[model samples]
Target: MLLISTQNITVKLKYYFNNNGQHYFQRSIPRALQRFYGDKKIVRHKLPSIHSQMLLEMNRLAHHYDQHFKALKSGQGGTPSQIQEQAVALLASHGVLPGAANTPARVPEGMYEYPHLDYIEDYLRDKKQAGTMTKVDELAQLLLSKPMPILLSQATDVYFENHEHGTSEKFKKNTLKRWKNIYDVTGGDIALADVTREMARRYIKHRLTTVKTTTVERELKTIRAVINSVIKEKSLNLSNKFERLTIPKKGKDSVARKPFSQDEYRKLIAGCVSKADEIRVLILICCLTGVRPSEAAGLRREDVYLDDEYPHFDVVEYGGRTLKTKNSVRKVPLIPAAAKVLAQYLETHTDSVVFPRYCDGNEVLGDNVSGATNRYIASLGISKTLYSARHTVKTLLDQAGTPEYLAESIGGWGKPSISRGYGDGHSLARKYAALQKALTTVLVNESE
Candidate 1:
């Protein structure tokens, strides 16, 4: 072992030999000795290059010299080589260099370079377009890597065509935020193809147990949709990535809930009357017309055809925004009971909206009505949702012997299997006539 330090001499070194690579110094080596016996000086004498093996040896020698000088300064009696070896062991233990105590890093057997990102990018891009998901990591990576305007263009497409207005904006923003979270978790540096099914599976697990199943499903669906859109646009040449991405089957695990019954419905409407009369009327509208709460909230006073031979209301204006579905803009014949509520509700309210404002003075958006309706349902001792009112109307129609096709039409449902054309005035009139005939015993004649 060698002990070197700097002193008056330009270059100086004091060496002591020991059987083992242990060393101690009897006196303090001056600073001049360190210059002569520096790391470069040692390398010059031992090896020409500071190769990996040489670096390890140099580190050992440096540590040993330091220890020897320290021990001698403290009056410890030991050979230079003995002290050096002790320091070498300590340095190795602390992972200063490759040694017996240090585990060698394993070289990856996989590919040296990242594979093609095009297939994955294209797949995720298509899915985002088809309404599969938003803020998808897979889709985002494609944009970031290629510097394409696909993300912005895709969002614009959805905004203009699919998601628009108030609640849709909320939905889009929320769904995109979830996609961002996935990117953050995945480090956002991986290619799409490398994003294996296992990666998606882990993401799903995190979403389901850590956050919410709804959130997971929304984000996953958005991502899948973006990939689908990319495929449709011919941006991706590979087969569906969704085919490879294994999302947990969520259908069986989701709980099915029942709608409110007639008596329960009455109780809920009554409870919400005091809390929010507007909400009460909206719920009743959903109950009578089989419209969704969002649809009912979107109703306008002008949409009510009070002068019709048989007075009814059209569901035209939606959420002070847009309609639920193209078919949802149909007219529902108002039973005398529903008409009575409408007349009474219109007496004081003068806004264009039918069920306009929430109790909190907020405009009736989908979310606003949902909370009010759910709370109203809960207050009535019914463990049902506000959406249950739509079901209740459907049940009532079924009990009244209305055919399923007519029920779907009257409810303004957009079932693709059904006729997509606007209904003839005569057909609606005939149905209402039949309904009037069926309820002749119970319904009072307004024309009389």
Candidate 2:
């Protein structure tokens, strides 16, 4: 029964605990505007109970109702068509296909009727009694015209059909997995129209209980892409509910991927050479050449060119791993130290892959390499991940006064504003010189 005290708003807040003891906010429309809102007057949404979040929801609703009331007052709110549209939109947004709303139970005993008509009807009835529904909204207009309804299950297939080129199988599978997760939460293979903003928010909330905020954020992003793809192909008027979401920051949300300090870099590299294991070779190559760990792990026997005047390795898409960007498919000049390490390793290894133990013919075992290297760094008392080596390379290159574009090329980072259609590219000798100078900061006595 407490009142919210934002400026110009004396909002009466009604809250109750859910089955899980979660709190939410309830609101009623101004009495005069109920008819314009399809005779609905009350609204409730699951809002966070944190004070700052509650205030944020307060501000958001204030602006929302301001626009809502203004629209109705100006004669721009519900009409017969707009009213039906709102019902269809809202029902779809809540995971109910509007076309199926009018389906009568036991229609002629076999007219291919939807079996759950009673449940849907009762759900509508409960909504009406709660004063959140208007006069019965007709869905015949949609059902008759668009007989072939789009469903969430069909969305990823449509999305990937047009967009899967140059992407890895792993990327496609992960995308499908994320969409399926969304579909499962919304009651399975539901109409695309049934996907709603409320459902998306709740999904994020639910997922945060199990995974990191960034992982949930990525899931939402992939879901959004699928929704947008469906909307484009079907020419549907569906709203994408997955955009511009707020994920409240919590501890352990994101570990800053920091570059290794010079002392740490020296110590880590020395440790790598001492072990001379597959992961250690990959780590040494990555630290010395500014390539990513995956890039090094996926390198093939043919990709490394140690006999050339300027020893370098190519980062082409290989072992079922696709290059992240077009620029990622370029070559990297190895420093003399990195070249020496690769040559020594190759003399004893006979596989077609440089990091043979970390790859199958299909793809590189990225997780295995990353976990092993990071754990190794920790064993030596360094707190950086394997990817930190890439960051360290960038830092050292800048310290060595390498040109920004050269640094970008070495790191395989793309710059959309610039074109790379010029002759060949930066010379290997030049790249070698830049990288050599950069490593000078990280130079230390090799482990005997």
Q: How many residue pairs clash in each candidate?
A: 47, 3
Off by over 4 Å in 2: 1-154, 157-168, 180-189, 204-217, 231-239, 243-255, 416-426, 446-448
Instruction: State the TM-score for model 2.
Output: 0.60
For candidate 2, write residues 72-100 as lDDT tens digits: 55554444334443444334323244456
C-alpha TM-score for every candidate: 0.52, 0.60
Over the stretch 1-448, how does candidate 1's per-residue lDDT look in tens digits? 3333356534233333222434322223444333222212221113213235544555556666576445535533233323333333222222232132223333467643322333334544666787674332332343333332333224324433533342455455545665565554454534343445556667777677665465566677776665465555645454444444444675546665566655675565555444446767777667656677776776677778776778887766433355657777676787665677677878877776676564212234567778877786666677888776676666666677866667677776645233533456566675565444433332233343
Error of 1 at 66 (Å): 54
Candidate 1 regions exceeding 4 Å error are: 1-168, 177-197, 210-218, 227-250, 269-276, 317-326, 358-364, 414-422, 430-448
lDDT on C-alpha atoms for all candidate structures: 0.53, 0.70
Give the Cα error of residue 245 in candidate 2, in Å.
5.3
